[model samples]
Target: MVKINKMLKSLHISNYALIDTVDITFDNGFNIITGETGAGKSIMLGALSLILGERADIKAVRDSGKKSIIEATFEIDDYPTLKEYCLANDIEWDDTMCILRREVAPAGRSRAFINDSPVTLDLLSHVAMQLVDIHSQHQNQLLTSPEFQLRVIDSMAGNDTLLSDYRKRYAAFRSAVKRLHEAKRKIEQNRSDEDFTRFQLEQLDAMNLVADEQEQLEHEREILSNMTDIKSTINGALDALLNGNSNALSLLSEAGDYCEALGRILENADSLAERLQSARIEIQDIADTLSAFDSDLNADPAELDAIEERLNDIYALQHKHHVSTVGQLIELRESFRARLDELENSSFTIEELEKEARRAKSLAKELAAQLSKRRAEEAARFEADLRERAMPLGMKNLQIKVELTPTELSSTGADSIRFLFAFNKNQPLMPVGGTASGGEISRLMLSIKAIIADKMQLPSIIFDEVDTGVSGDVANRMGAMMQSIAANIQVMAITHLPQVAAKGNAHFKVYKQDDEHSTHTRIRRLSTDERIDELAVMLSGSTVDNAARANAKSLLNIK
Candidate 1:
């Protein structure tokens, strides 16, 4: 026996629709829910859908005074990745249990939670998708959806790895193509504005701006502006030192001579004479240096004008570039040079990217071809299996075909798939969507879903009246198929067929009751005897007779 590792443990709904509170526990087997029409089976489904992050209307709230809460618990020890997802998303979860809860308040607001940690609806839906697959009768319309059909084919072909690789290659090709187009656009835009670029470059070149040149020019300008005062001060200092007769140097020389004469008679007179001589020598050097500066201090107005012009040019360049200093302008110049270089070599870059894109496209095409080949091979097996499965379900003359026509490469690959069908013996094959009756389509969809259930490792599948137009052996076979699927995962069917209901390992009945104030929907797990009674009632329309009881007993195999 296959070890059943995953299943929905229980669902608790409160104040949703006509259900004040309906709590049901489920086991890891084929659990069947049966009720008469308008008995609120669909309401229960709507509640489950809310926990799955489906939107709920305010009318779904049974009471305007309280909030509606729907919660589901799942045994997910078998789904390790789901646990990893919780950890990655920082959600609190356990190895043995995963809880999903949704609440709608009377104020028309809603919230979702995973393990009591608040979460967004999208995340809840993502996690819920991995937990349960609700296959309703409405999904039969997916037969006409090409994307759905391709996915069906791909699932059977086991194309996950190949399709992933092909998509990666396709993404790379697209990226390269995008780069090539951008490069071409840049080249065209730059060429259109090339004249402005060249003009700016020429202006910067003519200015001949240098690093630190502005500071140097400013110093020169200041010196020229003060040349006359500087020269006058230097000349006056030179005249006082040497040109005048009573200058400090002359006085010091006379004093030095007197000290030398007195040195012969005094003790410290020789030391005093040496200091006076040294002072006189330093004074003479200053006088000579000042005279040289006076000669060189000519206020050339033309040189000053040249300096001002150079400084102004530097300032204008700074203003144009919106920069603060010459260094920033220099950096901007280099950037312009780089853009020009790229524009000049745009052809080379475009060629390289195009080559890369083409190589990636070729690789993607090759992988797509391999995917197509695998799908073609699997289509044959798919056709054979559908025929075998459908024939047993009263589609004995069902000519099922999977046609693959070549098409442009896509995320799924380069194939257009159409499921063809012909129910009559002498009829021509046509599209399954147009040719098959509603009953036949329902059966066909079931066969496909069953095959998929075996291929995939899902936790649970809930079929909501998918067996709408089948009876007798066909319903029995449908139930058997559900049972077979349940051997690997949990299967739940919200059904009304007695034949289908009789095959459940566990059965629940949903019914309505009229209390004093309002009508309420309730669900209860049926006992074996109760199941017999319910099945008999279904077989004989509430008037259970001896023959209906016998037939129900025969269906349930009661001794």
Candidate 2:
């Protein structure tokens, strides 16, 4: 694990196309350059990639050259594994053990070195990767990717171990809840129709019967069916008591007269006659009740037949209702009737659903609060570090912020962290791509580096015309910011801003010129005058106007 504390200090490029030979040292932090359009501005950073193990390009070598060399020094520690890998790959690992270098040839071959020792491109890439990161434009579009989203959530959650647990449980709980809801929905979907339910319930309940009511009603019906025969028999008995010679009442009357005759002969006979009279009165009262019942009874065959038909109808109903007897029908009616009675008071299903929703919300709130607290700490630290780094870039107005609000627990958790910036004093800090403009993005990018450099721990962070959308004072500030950041980290930037160009500790100029066979690309280190002329040309245009050259000279002289 080689840690790059200092940015790439210098580079030596040889026989690399237009970059025939150039030796330049870099600032500890940000270095910016400005040149005319089509200048071999990209040669500087490209050389770094080659050293880090990108594929060799045969055409990149100069026309007459056999080999290309890109050498650099880094302020890093000697990592044992990287050292061994260098030796095995035939690359160099020097004593500083911090430097990584690469060499290439027209033969499509490449080699790498760390601290002057030999290592393969794979080894260099691995060791170099930890020390540098290149977050170019293409991958930024994938910010919404789930993998990235997960990483952001994990970082805020501060619990990789717990995140796994949450994921497993969330899947299970969501599945169970979904299944439960679907099952209830299906139950309701196929539920019996309301009209059918009402008809069945009414039919069953109309029985108005108890478990034993059916049996009692049946017995009473049987007695009523015999009304005609029973009434006739009772009538004959009553007539015998009232008028026939063999009638019980008449026989009792005769016996009473004989008793009265005997009473005259015997002293106890009067008492016997009185007793007989009392007994006759009691029998007469009972006979009167029976006569009334007989009078009320219907003797018509039609009435009896009608009653029998009604009995048959009830039996048929019992059979249709799947009841073994009237008792069973009554039982079914009573049970179902009670349920229907309660149904009248049953409430809506939404009431229960609302209660469940409140419960889920409460749980989500609790978890969200916990997540927010942890993120708050991280945010404060992140912003403070960014502010601390921006001071050196003359951006005392810089404010890096992480805004977190309480949001519903979606798949992304309850937090969203967007990088916000304010490059100007008292200006509202906007999101990275807001109306802040390109100059602002450049400064913001450096501020982010200042905040995240420790975590990144990479050897180089390249800025390619990142200040395109800004000029003048703002561009100058961007240039200064880039230079300051490169002090501690390698910042290789291609630029059109003259302020940024002048800030470079070393300068390379790229231009195309024709040879016999083909127009070849040419890049060379700037001599003192050549550097002045280049800066002058950028300030004054290609003709090197006197006033523009004078201003360029003045810019170069600024402390």
Candidate 3:
């Protein structure tokens, strides 16, 4: 037997639904709770659900003035996954014990706590799920679910690493497909705008716009536009300075000669002669500059027209590109150049992306095929084991077949697996849901779960009235199976069957107590004698005769 370390240590529930307060401590093996109809065994499970992060209601508060509190403690040293959850949630707990608590107020508000530290309900649920599996009748319905079916097959095949690797690659493949689509979209969008971009670029390129070219053209235009005025002013200045006999340069020369003659006699006269000579040289230089300007200022209409045409083209190009200066147009042109370059390379980029997507898909297909192959093998074994388990439960004629048919590749694999069943040997196998009765399904589910339990490590298993429609030897066998399962892990059954109830290592009874104004439900762990009486009451109803007592004792192996 596997050594059991993680178990539900205790549950403390107060002012919840029917019970005002009930505190129960659990042992490590098979613990059973039995009660008459409408007794509070289900209520106890309900309270347990609250601490496991089930939604709560104010109506559950037995006393209007007090809050309903449900707290559960577990020994979880063996569960590393749960310990990781505690670390992730920053909950304070040790290997020996951990506490989960839920409180619901009269106002319908609720709060959850783990190890005295408050936590989100989601986090609390995450920790709770790792420690317990409450297998109610609803979970039996999950046997029909494909996701659940696949999970069982995967667990059986010990395909955690394979399935995990396949899923990761599938995710990558999906991502690669998404990226390819995005890249194609970008290319399509760019192509839509490419023609306009090329037209704009061509217009600018044809103009050959240059930085500072526009300013230079404007200056030239101004000169050409005023060429006649410039020539007249320059010619007049040259005449005044040098061309006339009484011009400024001639006057300065005459003055310089007089000063030179005077300078032969006086030192001041020589200084005056030097000043006149400097003035004459400056004026002559000015006249020569004006003469050259006059010669160059010919108003050539053809050249001016050419310059005007070029300026117009530059201005038009600037307007078309929505720019003010030649520099901005040059920048715009380079941007268009880059866009065209990208357009040219987009085909190559798309090809690469498509190739990558294809590789990812191919790898995913191979992994899926491997997963399907392994699952098929496990399914065959599972079918055999399930039928074997069922045969002992009075279902000797049960035929369970696991069919793994090929389908499109998905996250799980390329298989549409189903469990086919036929109760009679001559009847053709059909889907389990269609062929099996409720009781048959319940037994089938228990058999499957037992098989799964052997294959996997579940912290605890609870059967909430799973033996609803069966009795006699079959019920006893079910109890024996539950007992056998408890050898490895904690098992609890909320049952009404005395046969099942008698097999529990520890037994508890839920009953109701009445007051003047109200009735409240409560539970108590039964002593050996008390267990006999309870089982007797379950076996013989409200009237427990001597025969019922003897039968109860025989079921319990008491003298």
> How large is the C-alpha RMSD of every model relative to the true structure?
5.6, 24.7, 9.2
Candidate closer to the true structure by TM-score (higher is better), 1 or 2: 1
State which candidate has the highest lDDT: 1
Ranked by lDDT from best down, the candidates are 1, 3, 2
Model 3 Cα lDDT, one tens digit per residue, 317-389: 7777678999998999998888888789998988999999999999999999999999989998988988888
lDDT of each: 0.87, 0.63, 0.86
Q: What does candidate 1's lDDT look like per residue over 387-491, in tens digits?
A: 888788888888978899999877777899888899999998999777887778877877887788766666588999988877788888988988788887899
Winner by TM-score between candidate 3 and candidate 1: 1
**Per-residue alpha-carbon lDDT of candidate 2 for residues 273-347, written as tens digits (9 for 90 to 100):** 778888888778878988888777755666657756655756777778777776676666665555454344333
Clashing pairs in 1: none
Worst 10 residues of 2 by lDDT: 137-146
Q: Where in model 1 is the C-alpha error above 4 Å?
A: 1-6, 53-55, 78-97, 117-123, 211-307, 426-428, 457-459, 539-559
Q: What is the TM-score of each candidate against the true structure?
A: 0.80, 0.45, 0.72
lDDT of 1: 0.87
Better of 2 and 3 by TM-score: 3
Identify the leading candidate in terms of TM-score. Answer: 1
